[model samples]
Target: MMSKLLKNRYLILRRIVQITILALYFGANAYGWKVLVGNLSYSKFLQAIPLADPFTVLQMLAAGAVVGVDVLVGAVVIAVFYGLIGGRAFCSWVCPINMVTDLANWLRRKLKIDRDARRINISRRFRYWALGTLLVVSFVVGAAAYEFVNPIGFFVRGLLFSIGFGWTLILAIFLFDLLILKHGWCGYICPVGATYSLIGSKSLIRVEHNHLNCTNCGNCKEVCPEKQVLNPVIYRKSGFINGIECTNCGRCIEVCNDNALKFSIRSFLKNN
Candidate 1:
């Protein structure tokens, strides 16, 4: 067990962080912790500071800037956090839906399901279209209308309130990932993910591939939710993963037997 853990430290750490975040919200709701309130869309910290999704704020700005001061500040704080750390981290390390999707992926593999054979042939460009649609709908409705159908909202509300309808949506996501698509929601569909990727385009921390030790074994690609980002970087065609969509989830790092991949400031890696 100790040997297995030492090899997969980052994966274990990410799981812990995800669980703790959910637990905090549940505690605040059930026991009045008051340290953090609200879900991923908009949240209060210490009952004073704010942390919010910048994309949601963007929709609010588009519709009308008739929002609260705390909301704006919260969006900025979140933007900075993602900008420094890389945005897709939000998808893998923070989003509650990730837990469901990951489990689906694991189960699909275990059951010997053909991931590519079952997926719908939807354009990956749809995420951008969906992002645009979300903003337009918000502008038309004068509110963050997407939140009503947002799985993230459903997941959080289910945790705080009752599973009710949310469990249905959650189960659908699990099934979608398990049987219909591999990495369907986050990689191909989510507007929140698209927005965060845009915000973290020039993030400081990123995955750096040292081609010297790389073996071209493709273990990293097998595990990556965003494998497209790894090919250029790992093959030495690019200095590092430049794609904004790279989530910095560190799965590639943990699975790399050659120890060629690592997390570092993008500039430092390039300079050396």
Candidate 2:
């Protein structure tokens, strides 16, 4: 178990970050800590700084609503963050829904189910389409239409407030990951993730593959949730993992016993 934990060091670190952030929200609510309050869409930190999701802000704009300065500042802060790191990093490191999907994926493997057989056919553009549709709906309805169905919001509310249809939405996601698709929610359908990916498509920081040390053992691929993002970087002499799909979760680096992969700036990537 110790050896296994060491090998999955990044994965463990991701869980800790995700749990800690959520715990702080609960802390604010249940204990009146007030360090951080509100959901992912909006948050107040230390009763001073406000944080808001850019996508949510866009929805509000489409609805022709007023955005406060604090909310705008918070959105910029988040944008700068995901812009520097990878945007999809939010999916792997911050979103609470990732834990549910990941758990279903793990259980699917443990049950000896053939993943390829259960996986459904879906275009990657579905997320972009979903994103466009959401904006249109928000414009038409003069409200954040997608917020009504967003599972991330549901998960946070369900956790801190009361259980309602949120549990059903979450359970449906778990079943979808296990029975219909390998990465159905975040990969193919999440508008929030799609929006962030666009924001960080040219992120400076990325995982660099040390082609000199690689043995093509394929452990990295086996552990990677976004396998296609690694293909060019690993095999085709690409500069870095340039795809917006990459979350910088570092699972590839973690499972590589040979130290063939590590985080570095895109400019520092070695050519084959």
Candidate 3:
């Protein structure tokens, strides 16, 4: 049991963080706890410091809304924070929908459903296109388009408020990831994720690969959500996994038996 816990520490920590964020949001809504108020799209820290999702702000801008100064500052704070660490860290560490998709992925592995699975061929780049389309729609429709149907919003708000279509949408995401494709929603469809990936493209914290220690067991890639990010560095050369899509979730590091992969500060001095 101790060994298992140690092995899955990062996963455990991620769950804790995700749940705690939700709990804080729920508490703020229900009991007026002001530590962290508001939803993921726009949150107020300690009721003074604002933290807005930069992408949501962009959608508002596209819709030609008069965004407030506080919201703009909040967006900058979030963008800079993620830019220093990693952007999609929001996907793994904070987003409520990640729990649903991760559960689907876990079930796929346990049931051996992923083995020899004939998966759909959705390009990961589709997320960028989706992001572009959403902005266009926001511009045309004069509203933040994705906000109406965002699964993350549904999952979070549904939990805080009354149940409606949110639960159904959340369930569909789970099923889509489980049966339709692997890493489908966040990888291929989420514009919010695409925006974050772009923001953290040159993040300081990154997973560094020491190929000399790699035994080629393939455990890291097997567990990585974005396995493509591992391809250029794993067994190829000792370098940073510099892909913008990497969530820095530490799954590869946790699963690797040879200690070939670990987190390190990215060196901007070198071209890596």
lDDT of each: 0.83, 0.83, 0.89
**lDDT, candidate 2, 1-272, per-residue tens:** 99898888889999999998899999989999888898899999889888888899889888998978988898888888888765578889999999998898777777755535645678878999999989999999999888988899999988899868678999999998777777778778999988888888777778877777888888888767677788877755535677788888898888887877888886423322
Tell me the lDDT of candidate 1.
0.83
Cα RMSD of predicted structure 2 = 2.3
Which residue ranges in model 1 land beyond 4 Å of their true spot? 268-272
lDDT tens digits by residue: candidate 1, 1-272:
99689777887888898888888888899999887888888888889989998887888887776889899899999898888666568888898898888899878878878735654777766788999998999889888877778899899878989767678888998988888888888888989999888888777788878888888898988888877777667766435677788888888888889878888787633432
Say which candidate scores most in TM-score: 3
State the lDDT at 195 in candidate 2.
Answer: 89
Kindly give the stretch of ten consecutive residues in candidate 1 with the minimal lDDT sum. Answer: 263-272
Between prediction 2 and prediction 3, the one with superior lDDT is: 3
Query: TM per model?
Result: 0.93, 0.93, 0.97
Clashes of each: 0, 0, 0
Model 3 lDDT tens row, 139-229: 9999999998888888777888875867888889999888778888888888998999999888888999998999989999887888888
* Candidate 1 residue 243 C-alpha distance from true site, Å: 1.2
Candidate 2: regions farther than 4 A off? 115-119, 268-272
Error of 1 at 71 (Å): 0.2
